[model samples]
Target: MTKKDHEESGLSKSVWSDADLEEMGWHDATVHALFLQPGEMASRLLLDLDYPVRWVPPVRRRDPFTFWVAPATLVFEEVWDLEGSLDFKGLAPELELDGIHRLAPPDGRAEYPLWHLEGHAFELKFRASGFRQYFRQAPRHVAGPMLEYADRGGCAFTEVGFD
Candidate 1:
């Protein structure tokens, strides 16, 4: 998803930007991002299948800890960069599940079975006209354990260390 498409998809373009993300300690290549609907809130954050969910306020934070939205249906995988130049890769001609837009994995990554790679930043779009916030766990904190969790699905566990 290009920045243009991301913007056209209903994300608050004015609120989230590369500079804003940088100031908040995020880069364009942050791992997969989680989304929340307007006024939605959660008390804890789950990084993946392994790490135990920790308490964190889901609302009123400037890019709170890149938490996971449970029930799995709200998470999204993006193949674009928010801090880069505009991409004109127009939306796919076909619309699935009604009017919802889905992004496809790029080139070599197509071979990847998962929806998208972890650690490449997540793009959260609004479900309605309301405030939506996002934050991410740095790769140093999530990569190893999260990958282990994904591989195990549930049987295995990954322990995380605090900074």
Candidate 2:
């Protein structure tokens, strides 16, 4: 589905609007986990955006502009193809997201656009009909110093927050 479709369907209107995501680019976002299901039963890819981006706090605090990290999950639906390599041995690696791009489908056979996700440790190219992003929880206010150590361990969802 297109951006308008998602908006009209109220799929991404809860926590993030299109303008919000446009302003807060995916650069430097940490990928804490990746779940890809490619089969007749399910064809989708889910990415845990650990340290997505800095957002203004809803309520003002001592520091007028204290930084916050809003963790979210990005999902690609109706995935027809997926190809990539990720290391999943001892512990799940934290892949620093570089960027996400929408490109023309290869060979013009697919019904949807192609998505290319570039990261510091991995690269993925897939053809998906559409995608959506939703926050895992309220934006967690974090200290400026803590940002440096945010990705030092497993994802907040897997390590602590999520059950």
Candidate 3:
């Protein structure tokens, strides 16, 4: 989505503005972000599938071990510019689900499938505002086995990754 469209969606109007994004020290050009904590069942399934997985050490001093054994699926959500669509290397292919409507009015539900590939990510989900959008994961990370699956191939295991 364009910056204006993302802002016009009113998801984060109070926190940022188009003008504010132009500031010299602006950190990002999108709206909100989410760090998904996977549930037990999902995590177990990945391990059962024998997907390549690893745990990376946490970069932050306060954070717990970078590598962890959890039973849940994890994904990062962030509002970003159009450029995120570019890279797709080393990412796992995903099954794209379509036609899921947003739950909220004005702002609808956002849901879609994402495959992490070669330093990039692919997503096809609807946002909370009822807008159907796709996403590509960007660089920047905390290492872990989950990331190891980023380079996996073939469609057989794609559906297993999502909830």
lDDT of each: 0.24, 0.60, 0.24
lDDT per residue for candidate 1 within 51-156, as digits (tens), equals 2122234356674453221111122222222121222256432111111122343443542212212222222221111111221221222322233434333321
Q: Model 2, which residues run further than 4 Å from truth?
A: 1-24, 38-42, 55-66, 86-92, 144-163
Global lDDT of model 3: 0.24
Q: Tens digits of per-residue lDDT for model 2 on 75-119? A: 777886678776656755768787888788878855578888887
| lDDT at position 63, candidate 2 | 60
Candidate 1 C-alpha error for residue 21, in Å = 7.8
> Relative to the unseen true structure, what is the C-alpha lDDT of residue 120 in candidate 1, on a scale of 0 to 100?
25
Clashing pairs in 2: none
lDDT of 3 by residue, 36-97 (tens): 33444331111111111123446787886542221122122332211224334665443221
Query: Best candidate, lDDT-wise?
Result: 2
Off by over 4 Å in 1: 1-24, 40-163
Candidate 2: what lDDT?
Answer: 0.60
- Of 1 and 2, the candidate ahead on lDDT is 2
TM-score result, candidate 1? 0.18
Which candidate leads in TM-score? 2
- The runs of at least 3 residues in candidate 3 whose Cα sits more than 4 Å from the true structure, single-residue gaps closed, are 1-65, 73-119, 127-143, 147-163
